[model samples]
Target: MAKPTPLNLLADLAQNDTEAATRELGRLQGLRTQAEQQLAALNKYREEYRARMQAMAQDGMTATRWQDYAQFLTSLDGAIRQQGQALAQAEAALLTGRANWQSQKRRQNSFDTLVARAEAREQAAGARREQRANDEYAARLARAASHRQD
Candidate 1:
């Protein structure tokens, strides 16, 4: 990738600090995906349960079968709650990873700014040195001409 911005120079160093954080974020995202998949499966199970319950009711099932249906509904409710908790945890992990990445970026930016400033200062100093040498050379040239005249 072409680095169009001045900040691109800091990419490598910043990546080192953020590497673990980035992995963590990816992990979090994967967990979220898994949770969603499980949630989908649970939804399918709920539909199946409803269908079975309906079939039992139509077939004039005994009171015991109705009790079993109630128990199944309660279990499904608990599973849904658990899936919600998992989603919350995954979201929290993603947030943590984002915070870490931002911190790393800030540190890298500070270092890049310092380096640029130091390079600017060095260039200024070199220019001053060159100017002084040129002044001294001019004075020497003037003296040589004056001596020749004498």
Candidate 2:
């Protein structure tokens, strides 16, 4: 069996876990902010395209106008498709980041639990050692008192 780490060693692990959790949480937050920004930008582009298409329709012109509208519609379709792909990619990245954060949290919790258990065991051992020392001192005092009387 692997030897258990000494109680003194647990402090380092606890500190490391705390630091890791903080870092992972920060990373997750950053990824979420980036994803939201990308989605917002995509929506803005789609809205701008809608406005332009409406303005073009109001003119009501000739064949050349129809061709221009067709070209505009095709470009709009491409932008919408690209936006959808980007949104999907952003969502996937967010989900992966969330999972990574959750995994880190679980590791931190495990380390915390281990450190607490180790500390409790160390405290109990210290108490036992103290009690034994006290008992030995009392026995010695009793023996000295008896010798003095004799």
Candidate 3:
């Protein structure tokens, strides 16, 4: 059984951090998508309402009916504006999340590189040790053969 390398342990922790960052980025992206969908729906409803108002105008609406339509359209416009703001905020959050994920990924890669280097060093050291052991064994066998000949 080989002892665990410190570099390997650090690499594991870095990988965990990367995974958490990825999850957070995914959540932010979901929120951004939902905000975009809501904004689209609001715009679509506003367009449909405008079309209805136009049709009513052709049919000769009374002054009161026109006033009511204007008021409702104003309210829709306000709602649409609010939704746009919300969408912007969500997009900003998504951008921040992406940046964080990238940073974590870079950290993980660095740790992985360190681990690879450590493993290579360990392997080289093991090889040297094995070679030395074989050389000593051969030397002992040569000495024993000389004594037997004597």
Candidate 4:
């Protein structure tokens, strides 16, 4: 049995790191989607509120009612902005995770290439040793036949 190379161990570690990075990227994407959904819902609700306010104005709303509606709309806008920021952050994190995964994959591939080269070298060496033994055996057989004839 051939002894294991350090490259094999390094490759295993790199594979684990790559898998972890992939999971992290997936989680970030999920968070970004949730943030987007919240932003969409907030905008939809704000539009509905504006429609209701318009209907109220047609019926003649009080000044105090107008002030309250304006304040609530402002708060909704602020929430929407905050959600947008969160989504941006999540997207950035996802990009970073993807980069890390790619780096890990590259490292793993390098180690794997090294391992393959080492195995090929070992196989070649074994083949040479086998050929040498066959040649030595043939030489011995020829000498034995020459001695028998003499």
lDDT of 3 by residue, 1-150 (tens): 335777778888999999999999999999999999999999999999999999999999999999999999999999999999999999999999999999999999999888787778889999999999999999999999999999
Give the candidate order by descending lDDT.
3, 4, 1, 2
Model 3: ten consecutive residues of lowest lDDT:
1-10
Best by lDDT: 3
Give me the runs in candidate 1 sitting further than 4 Å from their true place. Answer: 1-15, 134-150
Clashing pairs in 3: none
Give the C-alpha miss distance for residue 113 in model 4, angstroms: 1.3
Could you tell which candidate, 1 or 2, scores higher by lDDT?
1
For all candidates in order, the CA lDDT equals 0.81, 0.71, 0.93, 0.87
Q: Tell me how far the alpha carbon of residue 22 in candidate 3 is from the true structure, in angstroms, after superposition.
A: 0.7
Summarize candidate 1's per-residue lDDT along 56-143 as a digit string, tens digits.
Answer: 7998988998999989888997998899788788778778878887798788777667666767777898899999999999999999
Candidates ranked by TM-score, best first? 3, 4, 2, 1
lDDT at residue 125 of model 2 (Cα atoms): 91
Quote model 4's TM-score. Answer: 0.86
RMSD of each: 5.3, 4.5, 1.5, 2.0
Off by over 4 Å in 2: 1-48
**Which ten-residue region of model 2 has the weakest summed lDDT?**
1-10
lDDT of 2 at 61: 52
How far off is model 3, as Cα RMSD? 1.5
Top candidate by TM-score: 3
Q: Model 1: how far is 75 from its true place, Å?
A: 2.0
